[model samples]
Target: MRRVTAIVPALLAALMLVVVPAVNARADLLGGKMTLRDENKMGHDFDQILRAQQNMVGDTYITDYVAEVVARVVTGKRPMPFHVKSAVIANPLINAFAIPGGYIYIFTGLIQSVDTESQLAGVIAHELAHVSQRHVVSRIEKQKKVTLLSTAGMLAGLLLGIAAGGGNAAQAGQALVIGSQGAATAAMLHYSQDDEREADHVGLNSLVAAGYNPEGMPQTFEIMLKNKWYDNSSSMPSYLSTHPGTAERITYLNDRIARMPKEFLERKDDNTRLKRVQALIRSRMSPANTALAYWDDMKQSDYTPMDWVGRGITLERLKRLDEAQTAFEKALSLAKDDPLVVREAGIFYFKSGQADRALGLLQKASIMNKDDAMALFYLARLQAEAKQYGEAARNMRKVNELVPEDWEVHHHLGMILGESGDVFGGNLHLAYAAVYSMRLDKAREYLKRANELAQTQEQKDQVRELEDAIQARAQIGK
Candidate 1:
């Protein structure tokens, strides 16, 4: 099934390439209008495909941290024209990219590569600049001979191929896009040198305006350059390959940074959040052995409570319960008042069969941050384990509120609500969970059950709406 799924995009690319006339030859072809709405539509379509194919990180803490960084870059005293949404990809490749709309994707590798929040923010700002400046739309407009659908198909196929990393898949993707015009395909995949410089300049200003030190922009480029130096050219990151003129870019950014005001170059004092965010990624994203090795290699003097939290998680993943508990205890002792530390300790305790300890810590964490969906979810689980069905359902509902698209949360919430006698609500949530998980048949079954359990006309109407949504998504899958 996975193999078939992988081949489908390549097949589509091939079919489109064969059917559509060469973009360069068709001077008279009516190019699609590059309106904001059209750009958003394209981005939405691409986002769906990418989400289906990629392992997107669904942790609320990590995602929220990234969103907060993007918000600082894109949002200011002036409102943005379009809503920008960001997601973290689970890939270890050090790269980030923006689609046509305000859709930006950052890889875990990129997050791990940066030492500071401002450096991470610089990459985001650069991607956001690409969108805000309408670089993609402008490029599409320039290629007036190409149809939007075909171009989008070709681009998606090529990107998916590169992302998949298998030799055969990459070759198929390259063949589909580079059919008789490798140069043209390359041009389409990347922005011009002029556009790249403009994004750097615009992104630098936004980074400074958002109170990040302008030094972060040049520093980030330096990191990328260093990484590239250590890596073989064939193994070079996609970012470096697609984003040409990196050497020149680094030089330009450094020159710009040198001319910045003294006050603007001064670093911000609040990097605690950045450190915690990085710890979360390292703990959760890295393999257990790798994470343990990393922690082992780091000097003990540099280990903070957050670092202990990461070590605890890695130990837990490795099934070293005693050591994991000790790590968590050390973290709590160091920063007992910190909500994130409390939450991690709670989770570790729960996994170690100390339900009572887990409950207290999780409750404290929840109180500290009402929007902490992970804490709430764990609390709800503990409540259910204690046979407090009503309380469990309530907590699960809150978790659902905080993370509406989390299929697992919805699934657990549905079961809890069902056990608590809210059959209608349970079935509705179950249907939503199935839908989000792409279990269309299961979703249909749950929706039908929800429809039967609907007492109020309003409830029936809601079920009908969900049914319509399921049908629409089904068509898209086809």
Candidate 2:
């Protein structure tokens, strides 16, 4: 399946590439408008291309938090033809993009960049408006005559640069754009100035309707404007590099916010959840020195409980173990029962060889935040190291379920399964772990071992299923 559309915060910059189908099929300009069924299929295929390329966050806690915010924004909007879903990307760029059929992704950097949850929601609402208004679909209709291969190669190459592959496709795309088709492809992918205005108008209403402050939409734009991403061309595609109308748009948004009721404008957004998620991302996902600097720069009075945890994490990354311990202990003192703090602090201790102290904290964290796969993973490992194989295997299986695509989780789960005497299950998970880690030969070896050990028909069927998955995964790389 061949079609993919541009994605973004037009309020921040020009639309950026989120998906560019690499398939040979033709665009689905099927007479009237594209159907829901068609878009969903295209979106599914687009997801495959993306997954084949970059790491989408497999952490349930982070992704679920973003998805919950998406759900809230959707609640305020008119009934949508498509179901909007959220995927958090493991990218450092401060950008967000939406694809056809309602799949939106926000970079980890974007999460860390925003000051509040409402600011994030505002960007999300704007992207949602683009989808609801069918701006990309409309633009495609007008520009369908442009050579598909050049357009596809350009977009595919552009987002590819952001996701993982070297800029080969991007360079080729840029070269093609410099040729005759440049204008048409550009028009097709970017929202018109008018379209951007309309999305702002529509999205602001949705943001307010969703019970967020109207100032958030404009505030987020201000953050982007001040960000160095606005100045750095190589940081994002050239198309998004030039945002001439940003100041004007901000002026208008502020003017509109001025006319809203004072109490409504005064409505405060709860940043509790956003801060927790941001702390986790900064502590665990960001570059170590940069994260440490960020946390360090914050005034001591402004540091939240999770901020202290974030500080501890970065300090640990720098091997400042004594300092890290101090930070974690301070965070625990401030918010001892907070699940994120408890979980992260526990992990630090576990790794620091203070497993006896870690055991109870991690167990409490697992109970408090049952959905946090990371916490459960540590708890399971702790149990495994203590030779509590039955409990360890059980907990690891749950982690595997939540983070199925994660190779390390699968590997540990496989080891736990082996210790618990499920040799067939162990081999199956090991094979899966190898597949996810891209160790194809190792995966095949484990798959063969699994098949041999499968005595039951159920186990045989499971082995066959895993084989099919590995084959499909291989095809994506091709």
Candidate 3:
């Protein structure tokens, strides 16, 4: 994910090593892993595990942006997993990481730090490199035999800046005692100067291959270096330390850029697009900040359909409904052919309770882009709210099929099914919905099989209340 640039705990030192692993090592690391279907199952399972955490740390816009940017950059070359999921952890720190099975998180601070599209793209490419390579799963598997510092301990250290907090030495000691070189090994997880060089080389190659200017990487590093001047000052954020600057890293980047072809070296920045996107991001920032970014974009007339979309979105978020509507309409006018804009307009209509209009726009957007889950999801939601159970169920099912990691769809599906009088299916989905929503009572109802399936007592108890609720709801109907 493109990290939000801001102050953050320097946990990356302990986190850099546990990135994506090799594809071939995936199943083996998890032990008796199944096929792609099994991978999907694991993804679903893990998504549920993290769903609560996801909801608590809202502002998913960053996640959507990162995923879109990365996928856009690596379009044809790398096949993104069907259920690539992302969320922001609501931290003011500038850090981002990917968990096994495609769970990615970026902090808000990370978003605030970067100034350019390519710079953000560089971060995405780096994270994607981890995912495509399957680094995290490999580390998890490696840890099984060694029993490294407990996940809880590592998580605390990761979230709390163990190195800067003087916890690294202690964590390293723990790792050594357990014969677990995990956290200790993690601080040094950065590519051996060689691995670092390779990632830089591959990362640059990936950026250019993705059609972005490779210079974004060096430019990003340079921008980061600028943060050093602010170091230890009142305004300086903790992210600088977590990212850990090295003169060698910057020097290497400078040398690398110099070696590029002269034509490539002279490539122009996408100032227009960058400014527009930045404007939209700014609008989402505090009012004062939004005004600042808006003025910055005003100097550049190269706004695209996406810029309008971003502004529209920010307006909606700010609850300036009228202004937001105008922005969306303007966006639609500028890029009538752009399905994304149409979809946002449709959502605006849906949120405003103009169901018929929303459905029309959403259906049109869906026709324009067959695989757009947001359009389908909202359309399905409006249908369900209107009690068009069958159509709603069908669309919801499509949403679930396209993006099963989104548990909310299942919750909605379960409710629709229940309302439609399909008690059995409804009950099943209700269980899934509860599991995703972390609703204990509803979860238990669906947990008939889960009781046996659950390895932990907490999971067993989770299903107990759900079973009673399901039974009571069934009895009420009878």
Candidate 4:
């Protein structure tokens, strides 16, 4: 487990040194005239490390919602060299960033902190601008004296620091990379002041062109600034430290927004989906007590069906089954047609041992939104419990397609297929689940079994392909 964890970062570093074209006898600091392929390869490697080590939120609903926002941001924009992908990290820190290529990561805390969808879009646009502008590559090119080990160490340390709460851990990370060329390495990771300003300018333009309120840019900065004071910690937020001068940024963004046409500033994007996404994050990602308290506070004044849904979820997580059931019933009564509300009610019923009620509600939810992977997952599990192997396998297969990287989905699918006498399919999915879960040895074992069970040349070839991938990944560190 730890070996895979330790290997990928070093592998990424090695790739960067060997793949980057040398500029001169004195190494190029920034990116050494790296090609699009180099940037993408670096980003891809970093992304793997993140998926393996970070607490990524795998809920399909949440991911789909964020992807929709990304789509809107990139619409009509200049085509990126690499395909853009967004991921939500399950951390309660108000931060967002773009890795080299077009990979954007938003913390759950940032989503939870924003007042509206446009504000979130503003932050995303800023990160997207970083990738579009190739700031990471530029910064890497500037650090002429930094070694591959130091570069990798800095990237690993910074990411780990951000994941570990962006305080002491981040500072420790800086210290760890503070070798002979500490200043240069630090400069490489944190963009120059000019880069931040440029990103803000470019990002604001993209946000407005995408039809979002320009004010969202400043509003997001204000939120980050206010959070700085709210935290009152010995260390500032990683967002603040990494992207410095929040106050100045907020002021200028507001000035720029003011200078824009009144009509452009007033332009609105529908925030209904944004609110729903926030509710999901709060109910699912936040602590049970925290979510409970938040929903209780909201309902104390005026409550919507969504608020009731949130309360029910928090209550269920707290094991207050009776109260949770009542809350879900109320939510369902208030919004019988709402798929999310229905899904929550179904989950509540399932946990309370009312499989029939769970199945009915979940089935209804699936009809309402065939893409609701969570509902389908639960429905499949209930069917499996009732020994409806064929129906369960079908539903699980759909879910596996919907969330291919989800370890739990693959694990369940593997179990269902194995029970249904599809040994080859079962082992293949089990191998995938093991690989995603960083259990490389288990993955190899499953792949070997799958190879033995292959019924056709195509199946054998597929197994061999997977085996090669596993071998390559295993050798990454070495």
1-478: candidate 1 lDDT, tens digit per residue = 0011221221232222222223322334356556677666666656655554556776678889889889888853135556898988776567788876688888777888888888888888887887788876666566666532354555555564656654677767667666644454446665679888998998888888888887787677778888886754322355665567978998999888888788887777477777787788778776678888999999968889999999999999889989988999999999999999999899888778899999999999999988888888889999998889998998988988876766778889888888888899889989887887667899999998998899999998899889987886564412
- The number of the candidate with the highest lDDT is 1
Residue pairs clashing, model 2: none
Return the clash pairs for model 1, or none. Answer: none
Model 2 TM-score is 0.83
Model 3 per-residue lDDT at 110: 54
Cα-based TM-score, every candidate:
0.85, 0.83, 0.64, 0.87
For residues 1-478, what per-residue lDDT tens digits would candidate 3 score against the true structure? Answer: 1122233335442343342122122334435433445344444444443343233232233445566766665663366654556655444445565544555565544555677677777766665565555544434454533222344433334334432333565455334322343453554354344444555666666777776766777666666567757644322444345344445766776787788777765555565444543444455443444543563465336666666666766667667779778777888888877776788788888987788888888989888877777788888888888889999899889877765545577777878888998655566666866655556565664666556555566655655655654554332201
Predicted structure 2: lDDT: 0.73
* Candidate 1 lDDT score relative to the true structure: 0.74
lDDT of each candidate versus the true structure: 0.74, 0.73, 0.57, 0.74
Worst 10 residues of 2 by lDDT: 1-10
Residue-pair clashes per prediction, in order, are 0, 0, 26, 9
**Whole-model lDDT, model 3:** 0.57
Could you tell me the TM-score of candidate 4? 0.87
Candidate 4 lDDT, 368-437, residue by residue in tens: 9999888899999899889898999999889888877777788898898898898998999899888876
* Model 3 ranges with Cα > 4 A deviation: 1-52, 55-93, 98-117, 125-145, 148-195, 205-212, 227-242, 266-308, 437-442, 449-478
Runs with alpha carbons beyond 4 Å of true place in candidate 1: 1-32, 76-79, 148-165, 173-186, 231-236, 475-478
Worst 10 residues of 1 by lDDT: 1-10
Model 2, position 272: C-alpha lDDT score = 82
